[model samples]
Target: MSTQPTTDVAPSPPAPSEGGRPSDGLQAGLKNRHLSMIAIGGVIGAGLFVGSGSGIAAAGPAILLSYALVGALVVCVMRMLGEMAAAYPSSGSFSAYADRALGRWAGFSIGWLYWFFWVVVLAVEATAGAKILEGWIPAVPQWGWALIVMLVLTATNLASVASYGEFEFWFAGIKVVAIAAFVVIGLLAVFGVLPGAHSDTAGVANLTAHGGFMPHGPGSVLTGILMVVFSFMGSEIVTLAAGESENPQRAVSKATNSVIWRIAVFYLGSIFIVVSLLPWNSPSIVDDGSYVAALNTIGIPHAGEVMNVIVLTAVLSCLNSGLYTASRMAFSLGERGDAPKAFARTSARGVPRAAILSSVLFGFIAVFFNYKWPDTVFAFLLNSSGAVALFVWLVIAFAQLRMRAMILRDDPSKLVVRMWLFPYLTWATIGMISFVLVYMLTDPDGRQQVILSLLAAAVVVGIALVRDRLRASRPATASAGGVRDSAEGEESLPTGS
Candidate 1:
């Protein structure tokens, strides 16, 4: 009953720009290479670099399993997303799927919620990256560095899609290389082969000797999952960016297919090296980053500062991709009439100028909130957006279930990508995501985040329902008006035709 993959057509038409031509809209400037690195770079983020420290402390060496658990979750979600993205690539891929499979309300609500999450991400990453930069150059205030970082990336996005691709290719490349080098160098040190390095702390013994691998008990592995799970959030950016790629289906298929190894090598691989090199309980692990701490323990000079540079690279890359993602989602919403029409318009260079600026505008406000209230307004916004990853995956699972049935029913020939194990695995992924949500409700902090996210999601859903109802009623209202409406309709008809 399974249908084989097929060549994909151009993605849905881009929203008309100010010039009234589609060419003025987004261009397929992203090459396959860019797509590959974007996916790789998206998965290996600040979470693995910085957040892993807390995760190790919470669960000790067994934090690896927590990552594996979450990585499996990401793998499942990405596969489902890729199936749809490859079949019919769109900038609004998931939301569009929700629209067709679930309903416009699903699409509109999920689309806006997803956008909300990334805009908040833009603020968080900017502030994080600013700290790294401010460490090196004490002359500039942290806020000034944050502003500078945001403005630079915003301009990169506005310049053109190719510019964004080039920047990310290099940015992600550095991250890829840095982690890879760390793995190789760390392994060499572990085996006591590296030059000018001590290896007393580097061995498999460290994993068990410190705290028998599960220092905080098995409950802490779940706690570690809570601490480290958000690190996997940005892996799906490839599909969104792939809509503007030369071969959207190929790019998507490759990225989705390779996700496992990418997660394995970059995440599991580096974490394994770090833990093998130093005991999980080392105080330096938290003070410096996990990788930096491991490197310093192995006698790598200035390793903490050096890893800070790579972390800075990762932070900027995340911020750049965040702006790109939020704007495209907005543009998709505009094209579907789910958002203000201005967001749909692109510039002469095929950049969605309005969308980028608008996304950044909110980002600036979030930054202000971060500065103004560490615990009040900003905290709520942060938590409200925090739980969106699981919610999004849940939507994708359902959407894919519906999407699989649709592909099988209506157009099996267009089924270029199919979810693994069909309805069974789809349901499993859904159940797993639900479990995480319910689990969140048990922790006070997690409960606050889940509750706020739900409230926000509900508001977005309400707006979507009302907006859709008004839109649905417009034609009936127009029809009820008689000859004036007929005259208006006639006037609206294409003149030349």
Candidate 2:
């Protein structure tokens, strides 16, 4: 198979700028505030609202440490990516960086895999959002809500990038305020300060009183890690969105540098209060789910209804980001000739209309899978794509390691948002990712999904290798009397020519 590096030079072929729009299509419309909120909103998803209950149940309060561990690793990966992004910002983000620092195959494989990951995520979020909306308005079927949600977000994306930014900013802002309020209310209830509050159930003792922090033992910590990683998947979108900012470098640096604290405050801090106010093994905790249970425990009025709205918002936000990320990745692949050229075309508003439509269409199909085959097809889709989080994380680590050296070699000044401890931290992050993948193999629930995801990744990589070989084997030129080479490597020239 041909593995030519994308950066390898073979005579200049004139600039693509002549006929096509500049490589920065549709992205130039995003503003700074839109970017800042997207970074925040991307990290807080339905996982935080709903799935945290399972993690808390499994790991007890020690789930906080699980989130912290994963958060630290993400910080390292994002920092490395931010440094590279600042030096050479592009819509492709890691894929473009991989092409520059790694090779064509690396770019082709990771770009497609990342695109697959987000498209599946788009469907998952849509299904989740539909369920909540259906719960509120029972007259509409779940599938109907899913269609409406997908169509609405598709319209938002088909508009200018600025429209998307504005929509996401408010959507994300509401969730942020809700979580912040939860933290405050939970703290007051814990301290016996709020009216109608009960304090008998508060404090760190809740961590060990139920069954010790490792209630299910250290093995369950791995299980918790599996769930925890999914929540962190959207954090990388900041680096991707940063490419469109007026000052790409500053946007990346700011987002990467602050991720550590954001995780601490949003994920760990909120979970800490949840477990503090109630025993980890409480039936209500599992029955009502973590966030609702915590809110109900503090006697907060309308806690369930309030959190339902928040969770729904989180799901819609994820769907919006998923569609945006997937379409942008497809657009990048088209520009690099790895995908159909039509996906590369952009509207006057800079929106990648074809790419957006394609992603939304798949999302609509996934909603069908959710309704028609929730037990089989939907489960398989969830499991197969589950392992993609690890795969994408691994690619980010490798891309950063290679890109960092090139950036430092060419221009050291671009190291403003540098990773700590250089190669050691980078290698360490890779080790952690490897450990997570290995642990997935041993876990009963995650094993099949991990294997399926690995198989999917392998298939994509194989296709990339075969495509490279075919391109490499083709004749260099059909002109200059260089006839097509035949079976024995002999040129067959036209008799007249």
Candidate 3:
């Protein structure tokens, strides 16, 4: 099979100025430290704190295998993504790669779907954060809190890319410190080294006792995958963000290389402590929530309140990143002529002011639906975007398969971050993603998400296809004279009309 793409590839936008603060494009304002912390912190989402309780209850200690399995999947996908990102270094990330490797239609479809996913995320995280703030101060209604939180983060994103990085650095810093402390403290209690303990079950015995590790059986472990898989959505944000860093390729390569340890430490490590601290079936696991329950079991004071503070920080971090990510994707789409031109323009500080505001405007609308129509409209929005992460990963895998050969044929030196096992592992990733999507049909909730998400994808793909057909039918005189200008080395367009 030919690895070369059959369709014409659009050129990449002009490179940022040498000053690293380009007025025409995004600025390289993110420091190495900012990128480092973002890579470290991106994997630690609020879902780990709030949603793991159900997974633990459903899969028992075996949930660790679920995390490990999904972690392995993400690692592979990121490797493939890193390979292309290192070579191309675009804000579009996989979407841009898809444009050159597959076709513009593929890029348009996945890019819009991904943007939809994050804007929906904006609403979900806003509500989550608002609830916490309301709890802290009842005088302010939850709706008011949501508006306040959204405005603050929107302002942060609009300030400059560096401001976003700085805020995320601290936000991610808090999450990292909190999780590290939890693991260290939990380990002390687990090994019986702590001065005081609330539960004697804080030992390895908790793993085997109460129906053994696989309490609900292997089937339950498969089901648990559905629960924990979405928590890994933000793992790819660093790749998109790399375009705004001082050294995009190096930042991307480093972040990709480190994903394994980050997941192993933050996700698997934290979950290990929770299950080990108490029986998986313990009421605390569900009642108090996983992390909070584990803390209480170890005689921690005000466990719920402590976990609340940490979860709130995680929520805010997610909101901050969601806005930044969605805007960047919109900016990339606009640059490629797939969206309005205003989206591609930047302010004096290299901020995509129109792009940021447009993305936030949609996020605000989603938030309104969330408050006004929680069950119907918001529910539809959530389910429709639910499976987008897997879709993005699948597109990335396919894009990498073609991109690897394209890079080898063009400039092999740019292959700084290569995927392991080449076509074999890439095929395996595609297979795994397909399996997850197919498996979703078995669970009622998962089935709805799969169906609606597919519907949403079909709509976007339909639009892209229609646009392509219309462009093709235009007079040759108008469409001719195109030139090959892609930094990624895509082929040239037709001659002038």
Candidate with best lDDT: 3
Ordered by TM-score, highest first, the candidates read 3, 1, 2
Residue range 267-375, candidate 3, lDDT tens digits: 9999999999888998878888999999988889999999999999999999999999999999888777778777877776778778899999999999999999999
Question: Residue 248 of candidate 1: its Cα lDDT?
Answer: 75
lDDT of 2: 0.76
Q: TM-scores across all candidates?
A: 0.90, 0.90, 0.93
User: Which residue ranges in model 2 land beyond 4 Å of their true spot?
Assistant: 1-23, 477-497
Once all C-alphas are superposed, what RMSD does model 2 give against the true structure?
Answer: 7.6
Cα error of candidate 2 at position 315, Å: 0.6
Better of 1 and 3 by TM-score: 3
Candidate 2, poorest ten consecutive residues by summed lDDT: 488-497
lDDT of each: 0.81, 0.76, 0.86
Residue-level lDDT tens digits of model 1 in 1-497: 01112321112233222211122146677888899899999898887898899888878989999889988989999999998887667777788678778887888899999999999998899889888888889899999999999998988898889999999999999999998999899888878888888768788888899869888888887887888778999998998898788777688889999999999999888999989998888898898878889888878888877888898999989999999999999987776667777776766566777889999999999998998896899898999998998888999999998777666665565567777888898898888888888888887878898999999999999998887777666754353323122111211101111
List clashing residue pairs in candidate 1: none
Cα lDDT of model 3 overall?
A: 0.86
Q: How well is each residue in 1-497 modelled by candidate 2, as lDDT tens digits?
A: 01222231221111122111123444456677888888777779888988888888888877887888888878887787777766666677788677656666777788888888888888888888888898889999888898899889899988778877888898899989998998888878777787888657777788888888888887776678887887888887877776556666677777877888788889988999999999988887778989898888877779889888999888888888899899888877776667777776677666778889988887777777877898899788777788887777788788888777766676676567777888899899999999989888888877998898988888888988887688679766453334221111121111111
